[model samples]
Target: MKSITQLENKKVLVLGLAKSGEAAARLLAKLGAIVTVNDGKAFEENPSAQSLLEEGVKVVCGGHPLELLDENFELMVKNPGIRYDNPMVARALEKEIPVWTEVELAYLVSEAPIIGITGSNGKTTTTTMIADVLNHGGKSGVLSGNIGFPASEVAQSVTNQDTLVMELSSFQLMGIESFHPHIAVITNLMPTHIDYHGSFEEYVAAKWNIQNEMTSDDFIILNFNQDLAKELATQTNAQVVPFSTVEKVDGAYLENGGLYFKGELLMHADELGVPGSHNVENALATIAVAKLSGVSNQAIKETLSSFGGVKHRLQFVDTIDDVKFYNDSKSTNILATQKALSGFDNSKVILIAGGLDRGNEFDELIPDITGLKKMVILGESAPRVKRAADKAGVTYLDAKDVADATRIAFEQASAGDVVLLSPANASWDMYKNFEVRGDEFITTVERLKG
Candidate 1:
């Protein structure tokens, strides 16, 4: 493990006061680094900044001042959510100062071999599944990173014997200098977060950064079903292990209703508790990770069969009057929503979609609207989605928000139909995040049940 002493006496600037930034600042201070934290949120609004000030660390709140860069800081730890276009970040680049994310700090200090998972969708489910399978197999797995808990928090106590399973976002991956994972898995690649990265190519490059420091000794599990992932195989130095739900591959594949590893049966595909064909791909990726980690088939099977799924990703909410409600608030992109829709019988589905406009066109989703009983649209991108629905010759209605959308969907849904809240865009337009949007949907559904 890289020594934390490397940070001692180093001048470090942490941008943003979010969870990752706060964790990083505290950790850096604890490691004896001279840390300065800059956040756009005011000091009074950020208790984290106040707490850091008490620790004798410098706190610059309310906004990122360009003058702060004059401090001649040796390194900068940036929150993944902060775009590279930030003035301070641009200045840092101009000065040739190294900018790193909390993920990099976590990697430098962590003693365990990290298993980083990234992709447009299924990251949470795949990460959770890997950890569960490893734990069941007698190997301890500590979950962290984009799964909510900052990796810096988990890195402090992680041992070499333990496996650190992380769900990494493209934003986090973009800032890494040497954050290498022993087992890296990209479930699948699709156009996502274009606004953040500025373009599809840049977004793809950011996701590919996960393998930048990996060696041949490392394993990169990819989706063989995805052509982009297959193309990525040629670019990585790590051992490429492909998983597929389509046809048999060298690594993992689904055959005759069974999941197989190198032609050996691991478990029955139907036995997996998670619904959807997309999840089968997730399972395949997780199975590869489990097998590589020395997890036994029995443990893998047990975890797969018992694991209901991660919250907010096609989670079954309830059934009212024979109509089922599903919460897929985690579907924050068109590709994700399309996959969610593909999970159900189109004729029996009433879809609630639309959210923050990420400058993404909904044309790709037009064809998938086939057989959808109805579409309830809302948020910033509702009009764009409605246009696509119109082109598909599908019926739709606009609601003011998720609550109104839920009510409309429930009213429209008939017995035996499924009400799916799978907004094909981010939740920033109306809700704090996808979780809040999902909780509101779930609460609304429960009220309907009452």
Candidate 2:
């Protein structure tokens, strides 16, 4: 990590105390900043804030007292999940105090160049692919950001010889200033997080922030298939390397049934270990990064050929009586579920869906439901999902939980059918996160085997 003296003696406010917030607070304190951490959780209940207090950082807990902003703080490193309209955040903005997410801190401290990956979907898979292929080619690639590990924590440990492969989210990007990555990848654009971002335009604007400080020397890998991505290419100073599954591009693309990078054939399109055209797009993006990093085509080929895909994302569980089960619990939005459904023969899919009702209808999913055999709906969005299913003329059932959904899907599945758990909404209404939701599905599937 680079030794940066910019924060020395600066009064910084860290709002919220998730892994990112805690890491940012600690890192700021280490840099001689007078750090103050505020969390909505009560002091006794917030272990991270308590620990920071023990280390001499000021702690304000129980609630976000608006008066905290009167402290004349120079910067506020907020938890990405915290809304910008949050009183403290809004007040800070009004007062002209810079607000940032921990990702900015990651950029400030890391000696290594970062490869930031962000999009509506496929960020995790693309980040994982680039990291894996880089590592396989003798390049040091550390995974961080929204993929689970805090970018602040990972950045501090990586040296100039390593590459930080970060999975950035629009929320985190919305808070960046000088957090520029040497290589940036936007997997694709879609309308999502409308609740948090307020609109698709705002969300897209936030994602665009990933390239705020990029220059001509940098590279931004874009999706040629997306009009928004193509438009973005013309706006960034970074050299645009396009990836597409539809037609040939100057960079990575598929042509004549083979994946090619800059006119050189890498592998057959069907040779990728993971299924789906979405995975193919992800692979094209990965190939662009790999080739840019000087990774051998053989290493890229080997990694892509064996990469089984990320957990909770179209993950193959096990087959029971010739009926296959897939755990795609990470599909928290309609577009994701659509992509997941596109990977299988819909006529043979017994889909288990429904979760948090994010104030959006499932009408968009009707087109994708044309051939599904059955849909097992659950959680808060069941009624809405059932409405869409009804409109699509697909058979539907309701389940109380993942266990019930899994059992019902299995029962409905005939030999050669797929029991897919790809909830098209957030799991906050029923589970802590998608991983937990996927885990429950896997556990129930295992029980079915027993």
Candidate 3:
């Protein structure tokens, strides 16, 4: 394990004072790193910022001045909320100072092996599934990420023999220099976080950085069904293993209602606790990582058999009037929402969408909304969503909040209808983050039941 004592007296600049950023700053300060926490937003005006300062963190809020960063620093750790093009980051690059994401910083001190998962969609599900598989494989101390926990925070508390699985965002990948994973994953790429990266290509580049930095000694797992993932494999030097749900895969596949790895049957479909075709793909990635990690077949089956679905990825809440309410607030991208839409047979679905604009175009799903009964728009991006829904000639309405949207959808719903909260944009304009946004939606729907 890397010694925390080695970072003593090291001058570290921690960017953005969110949970990950604040966690990084606190840990660094405890390790004796002279940490200065900075946020592009204001401290007095933002409660989150104010809390960080109240906790005794040296804070530079309401935008960072480049002059404040001119001095030599050992390292800069940034939150996933900070994109690569931020002015401070550009300046940091010019100065040739090492910059890392919270995940990278956590790994530097973790004795546990990293199992990284990234994709435009399904990252959270895949990460959780992989962690479950590792735990079932009899590897104790299984954590999502050590020190930098979104779900991975448990990694820091576990023993070295434990396995660590990380759901990495592109923002996290952007700042890494030499961070490598023992088992890396690309669930499948699609357009996401386009507003931050300025373009889809740039976003893809940041995601590809994870595999690009790995050597042949490290293994890469990807979905063969993703054409772009196949193309990306050719560009990287790592050994590529592929998995698919719709067809036969070289590394893993689904057959006869069961999941198989290279002709080796690992699990029955009824054994897996997760549903949807995407979950099947997630299972494959988990099994492949398990195989490479020397996990036994029986262990993999046992782990998968008892695993439950993630919080906001197509989570089933309750059925009211035969209408299934699914909380997929975690699907903050058009591609992710599209995947959620694909999970069920199109009959009557009320898709509650709209949030902070993330440079996304909704035209891709317009032609495919044949079964969409209605669409409700809410939050900062409501106007944009209404515009797209109007163009598609679909029934659309603007709601004040998630509750309003749910109520409207309920009034318009029929038996066997599906109420889906899959906002294809960030939640910052109206809420603290996606988790809050999702919780609000779930609470609203449950209230309707009463």
Candidate 4:
């Protein structure tokens, strides 16, 4: 790994003591940087900040004071969730101080080749699949970033022999300066996180940041079906490899029920354990990354057939009374929910949806719900989603929460029906994150089954 000596004695400010923030602060301290951490949560409530304080780092809690900016820190490692609009962040930018995310620090010290994947959907599935493919091929592949493990923590342990496969979000990408991945994959870009980015154009631009530092020697896998992704080919110096579900291309393509790479059949599309054509796209991207990483076709096929998919993503919870229940709580956007619904035959589905609104109009989701047998709405966006369901002429019921939604859906569903929990909105209004939201749905389903 590269030595972090450059950061030694540099004054660094860490904002927000989230997972990434904690790791960055600890790493900075280890590198002998004067690390001062500021978190909005009080010291008693912020365990991460408390840990840093025990290590002799300066910990400021309860709020982000403007005085912190006057400390003349050389750099600020702000949490990805802390937007540029934050007063401190804006002030830091005004003072010409570099504001970075934890990923930037990880990249600066990491010795391993990195494979970064980003998109509005299917990033987790594709990132996990790529790591699995490499591992099956007898290579050490470390998974991190937005998938759970902080990239900063993963980078510390990875060596030149290992491959760091990261699931990057646009939020994480925005904070990167020189963070470049050897192999970058953009599964597909959609208008998402409008709440954070303030516009669709800005969101798309953030996802494109994955390739910002790539050179010709690097490789970028793009989705042929997404024009926005395809248009990015000219913007990067990296070699572009496109994967398509519609037509054959020079890269990976799905034709005649088989996945083909550069005109050679790799595996039958049906052999893939994950459902949905979106997953086919995810698999194709994984295949491209595996092949580029020197993994054998056999290993790729083996991983594809065995990889059931990541949790909270079209995960099959259980079948009680012959009704199949699926937890897709990770579908925190309109397009994701549409993709989830497309996986099953429309008429056999009873969908449970609604969550943090994010000001997204559900009118676009109307057509996707046309085939649903029933719809159960809950959380903050229930009223908005209910209006869309009404517009689509789909029968829907109102519920107070996921538990209520699950009970109502199960009651409305019959044998041979699918009860799907695919909230098109985020869980921030009702729960901690999508994982917690999904777990609650699973717990509720299991209780009913018992």
- Rank ordering of all candidates by lDDT, starting from the highest: 2, 4, 1, 3
lDDT (tens digit, per residue) of candidate 1 on 69-145: 99999999998877899889999999999999999989989999999999987787788788888998999999888
**Model 1 per-residue lDDT at 390:** 88
What lDDT score belongs to each candidate, Candidate 1 first? 0.87, 0.89, 0.76, 0.87
Candidate 2 shows a clash count of: 0
Q: Which is the better candidate, 1 or 2, if ranked by lDDT?
A: 2
Model 1 per-residue lDDT at 164: 94
Clashing pairs in 2: none
lDDT of 3 by residue, 1-450 (tens): 456676788888987765566667776776678888887766654454566667766788888888978767778887766667788877887888788877766676677777788887667667767766766677752545311243323435655787677778787888777677778999888886777888899999998888766788888998998788778878877888899887887888888987999998887877887656777888888889889888899988877776654567777656575576888999888888887876443335788999998766778866545336788899777777777787666788889888888889888898546788998888898888998888888888779988
Candidate 2 lDDT tens digits, 1-450: 789999999999999886678889999998899999998978865666778888999999999999989889999999887899988899999999999999999999999999999997788779888999999999999988876578888889999999999999899999988898999999999998788888899989999998889999999999999888888898989999999988789999999889999999999878998777988999999999999999999999999998864679777676677577889999999999998886555656899999998888999999788558899999998999999999887899889999999999998888657899999999999899999999999899889989
In terms of lDDT, the poorest run of 10 residues in model 2 is 339-348
- How good is model 4 by TM-score? 0.72
Cα error of candidate 3 at position 20, Å:
0.7
lDDT of candidate model 1 versus the reference: 0.87
